[model samples]
Target: MLSKIHNGVPFKYLIASFQHQPRPTFPRTSPLPLRSRPIRTFSVQSILRLPDSKAQTGSRHKFTYDAAASFSAKHKDFNAATHVFHFNPYNRIQTQKRPKSKRPASGQDAFFISRVGESNAVAFGIADGVGGWEDSGVDPADFSHSFCDYMASAAYEHKPDAGDPTLTARSLMQRGFDDVCRDGSIHAGGSTASIAIASEDGMLEVANLGDSGFVHLRLNAVHSYSEPQTHAFNTPYQLSIVPASMLARAAVFGGAQLCDYPRDADVTQHTLKHGDILIFASDGVWDNLFNQDVLRLASRRMVSLGAWKTSDGGILVADDLKPFTQSLAEDSAQRSSTLQSVIATDIAAAAKTASKDRRSDGPFAKEVQKYYPEEDWHGGKVDDICVIVVIVSEEGKQQAIKSKL
Candidate 1:
């Protein structure tokens, strides 16, 4: 499903299920929204209070940020000026009926980050939540926060900085992951990691712990930057955390197991250009659409990237980003609400789609229906349709230069 379309035509990589029904008068919701939406924002204190590995075992640190001094140094003025827009239209399959369980963060998915000491550049990331029959006070979003912050701390504490910033970025992710996994406090489930780092010197690096991946959309081409694999094995030792069945499902698509964390995709010295977009996408969006499809939609408009500027003396807060992205789902309704900013979403929220379940009878086997299922992506385990797109302008422009006629 991750194929980019050129002029509304499907490419080889894009496998159109051929399961779409006639356009209905009402809106339809599915794994793909062909649109994006806004997400909730976490305060700086929330980010700071996250647990570092040492604290995971037992450190009494409540996991909160100190409000006195500022740790973020004007992230709005940043040179990258990357505008990110994303929506998880098919997030239901990932959510659960939430209840108290064996582990915290059972069914909560969050996008967390931790920056280096003085560098505005990020150092780590965490996502995915698991909750259901398996395991409550702890949300997966919480793990994402602590895990990312700690990763940055661990990397800075390295014996000595590696000469190459890119290598250092990679080392930071690898070692930090090891630290999180070693802790006895955290439990394992559906949670996954797709982390990355960019140093002040212009080096980029990323690593993922599951099928989720990153996309780099240049002016014309879209590049994938994550490897899909898991820790599943017939050997008893592998059963320590991740189950063999889960691992087998991951490997069904030919998974990889490298260095310490299953597998990863990296770049030694990837140089970025102006108008370039680097997206850290969850499976909800990536699994349903190809990377090129993203580029196609993004290239059509000049997204407001006020959030990525860190040099203009403005700090790109999550609030600054929410509106720009939320606009992707314009709603013509609710025009009087002062709180409403952008209206880019469709009017209807639900629709009756088609399914091929009736045509197939695989003897109760694989059940390959060879068709699409009817569903809505608005508020359940799959609640909340989302798509995050980050647009970066080399020229660093959110304003247009009007010419005198």
Candidate 2:
């Protein structure tokens, strides 16, 4: 549903005592109070070859809307995405993880929690599956699911190392990527990933692969996660991995070689105010808007916090004093992003504009375009996108990462 908050409200979550409000039937698919939309058709398909599966079986989480989100708390132990936001259709396909299989499985998206404290230390994420690749009857929905679980585990258990949470996060993601590659599915299927971690001290740490991102609303302004545009529309991210010497030989795109910089990083730290809001979304939600747009939406909410409840009474507090918290992000200057609303809006506008203009005919090509800027878009055109935006305050502190390795 095209849920909008042209005003402010309080924040709430896992509202167990709430009622289930199914999306109202609109003309579109399973419509329920969603924005008016006509069925969109794809003209081309794109293929994505991701890492192979490995044998590590256990319970994991995934999404059904080809999109998902992670938050600091748990409504229940059920494997599902926390933080109530509607699934973004730009993502398209979603999957879950399994044990000992070469790939993941297809299933409903559930929330998974690995507590760092009573409600302090936690990590959550969402991944979008590639559609064109799945057309061959080979869905990596499961692979994306496994990737999120693996990544979340690593984040929750991260060490302080360099105050560089990004480095640590990327290393873990690469390890996961490497594991899949070693198993033999490097070219089978792939997904876009985004994650957020809460520090016991009340800070934010984030990592990303592909375009999914995070947005933060502190006091009055909004902010976003790191920027990612590794390749141009004509090339692919992996294509640049070959012989540094050969690439040194061709150097075709002329763009700065995909920023060797990790797709992830350590977000700045600061005291979270009460009037704040954070949001993480797949390309579907972001491909259509920008930070100002998000701010515009936030300004509409008449309450301190407001998130349209989508899941089973998913509690999105309408009055959480987040406004008091976010109201300070800009003046704080001690942190990075302003807040989730700011970040999500900016990213979405760029991605949506870009997706509408892609010309390639790759498998899942429709999905990959969600990561670029609409006007001057040029990059590897990663197949899927994942985004995470968060609002923090004295009431909403980050869950610390418990070092595992």
Candidate 3:
């Protein structure tokens, strides 16, 4: 048996691998009609897999500056330019999900971070391949990675009109899915996608399908969240559960018919404020950690950080954060690794306590009951967990202001 962390917590890992079979040709999906749609904007707060335990210091944090997409031009009333964003992402393969035989490892979870086009706007997302596709002789990871790549492209190509982000995001899923099926490189496997786009105008648009989700925080408290679209407990809506067709669609499981419709997504918009943070995660993180736990854990880290940047250029630690991170670096080979360890330990502890407490019927109890109904439920639920944290700092806000001037 293997052990791993879900939602920054420790849990028993379950291993399973998909044997790669020859890719078969499938009918290509026709492009969905492009139409402008109106999206509701809520007056509210805004809001990684680790390749390694340590932060990768090789590259500068990818922040693209596009001169044409200034915040002032988009919305002249607010003298702010696009929000300059920074992010930290972490990913780990679940030991339980590994195949015992000697085979190339396939990870179904994929995360992406990039600057949207020439704009200072940032985009981040996570895609989880449906585990059910393993039995169909297809690898979900391929689908997930390809889908996320398209999402990043969609973000870059997006041109919002009338301050409406609906059409921009809708086009990404519609066209991206078509390209994914048209290309012969990727297999016909289904997956779930959760995407967050922080526009140059400081407005946020999050679009999602299935269980992957995100939480938004203002200072230490949660301001909003992207709701998970699950048919039932443990059964999430995915791109395409059936391998017969290469369409990107989702439906309720348990005797429900699935389709290839690309528009089956839940999209929401939010107006962000300074000092806001957004956490995008797969089901693994949401199932194990409740909203409050996420809040508590993040708030705790914010304190431990004692005013620091989570990602500097490409390095996880910046000069100003050296003193605060020095203690963490001493404990582990990398400061990011140490931070991951601490967050995981804290989340696991929270899950344990929440399971026993019947007072609140939240995600913890539901997760334990859903995943471990047959056995004694202890600790957190076992699943592949990935988390991406993005902060909109005072400095970032100031930079946005300067860009407009």
Candidate 4:
């Protein structure tokens, strides 16, 4: 029997075998109607109480970020050195004449990192193509890759003065989705998205839909994270384009496709701080690793690289990160590595390892055990994994290391 495989599990199989299984619960709003709806307006301001900083003195402090990405397909081996992307704001973004072979080795999962216009801000995110689309003879990669491409272009060409509304995370997602709907090349597909925009003034905004999510880490702790939006077990809220034939079939068969709009994404705002780590990833990573696992992976990398140090009071960020964040050489290929790249690749590698482990139960396995105690599911759920890491640093702010107590 044909089934929708997401996170390496067949959705139909679980539903058929455990008809009375209690659904796993998460903190999320009820699924919205599958129709056009007004975008929910959200105030973009720092909601988290940030540590003592110059920004708290009513003066804006300029901040910079070192961003990189690492990804791998479930069927492929992960190479930490080669399968990494270092984000450079000055690099030119070419959306035309791009071949499919040039896309990241993320399989059906896609990601984009683009400088928002000429501003000092940056936008980056991930999109996970619904694996079930493959059962319908659709190439899920086409939708996800194209969706990210359109978003990158839109963000690159964005202008705050051109009578356009301010570019918020949700607006960027909506723009990308709108372009995908108009693109004649994409006939039918679906994907989940998690996007973030970090401004130079230390404010960060995020819009998340479905299982893909982002986490904010500071001082070796999980400061904040996103809640996945799902309708049922393994059925995530997804943005989709359905063909007329599929719609007609569904109407007669008395079943409907899960189609969600970008406006349905959950939005949150935060105040970024020096040495803070932000991780944006698809469900492939989240399903295999918990927040604490990610924190441990990143903390180990940061400390080993001297980007973070142990102090008497607590952990302290290094005063200078340029040595650790900047590229080693001018050549792109030969550039040795940076702190952010290592962190990104390390997390991806760990997730990949966990995904293939049969003895160690991951988050997805725990969820299955929670809802369907009868189903004998174990270990990790393997899928296409993508992770983007950002290390936030404030300019001219020196972190003082406390003396031994």
CA-lDDT, candidates in order = 0.32, 0.35, 0.48, 0.77
Locate the minimum summed-lDDT window of 10 residues in model 3.
Answer: 36-45
lDDT of 3 by residue, 1-405 (tens): 223222334322111122221121111133322211111000001112112212222322322211110001111122111211122221111222122242112246666665554445667777777655555667677677676666666655555543636444545666556766765766567777787677545677877887777778765667887766654344456675344332212222212333334577888898775446576766656655767777778667755655334444421322232233112543442333323233433443444444334355446444444454543344544455555665552223444555698
lDDT of 1 by residue, 18-51 (tens): 2211110122123432222111001110112112
lDDT of 4 by residue, 1-405 (tens): 333223455444222111211112222234533221111000111111112322332435577777889999878999877788888776777765246888888899999988887776789999999877766678888888888988998888988778778899999999999989998888988899999999878899999998889889998888988888876656678899888877776666555667899989999999999899999999889988888888998899788778889999999888877777774443574367777777888889989999988889888877766655556668888889999999898866753333222
Error of 1 at 389 (Å): 5.2
lDDT comparing candidate 1 with the true structure: 0.32
Better of 2 and 3 by lDDT: 3
2 against 3, candidate with superior TM-score: 3
The segments of candidate 4 whose C-alpha lies over 4 angstroms from its true place after superposition are: 1-58, 328-335, 399-405
Tens digit of per-residue lDDT, candidate 2, span 1-405: 223211111111110111110111111222223121111100111111111223221312110111122221111221122222322223222222345352222221222223322223445555554332333345455455555555544444445443535433456556445554444443444555555554434455566554444456543356443343323321112211222432453354332323222343333343343345555555444434445555555544423234222335433333333332233243343132222433333443334334344442221232223332132222212223334444343322222112232
The candidates, ranked best first by lDDT, are 4, 3, 2, 1
RMSD per prediction, one decimal?
A: 16.0, 18.9, 15.1, 8.3
Question: What TM-score do all the candidates reach, one by one?
Answer: 0.43, 0.43, 0.58, 0.84
Error of 2 at 150 (Å): 1.9
Q: Please name the candidate that would achieve the greatest lDDT relative to the true structure.
A: 4
Candidate 4 local distance difference test against the native:
0.77
How many clashes in each structure?
A: 53, 116, 21, 0
- TM-score of model number 3: 0.58
Worst 10 residues of 2 by lDDT: 14-23
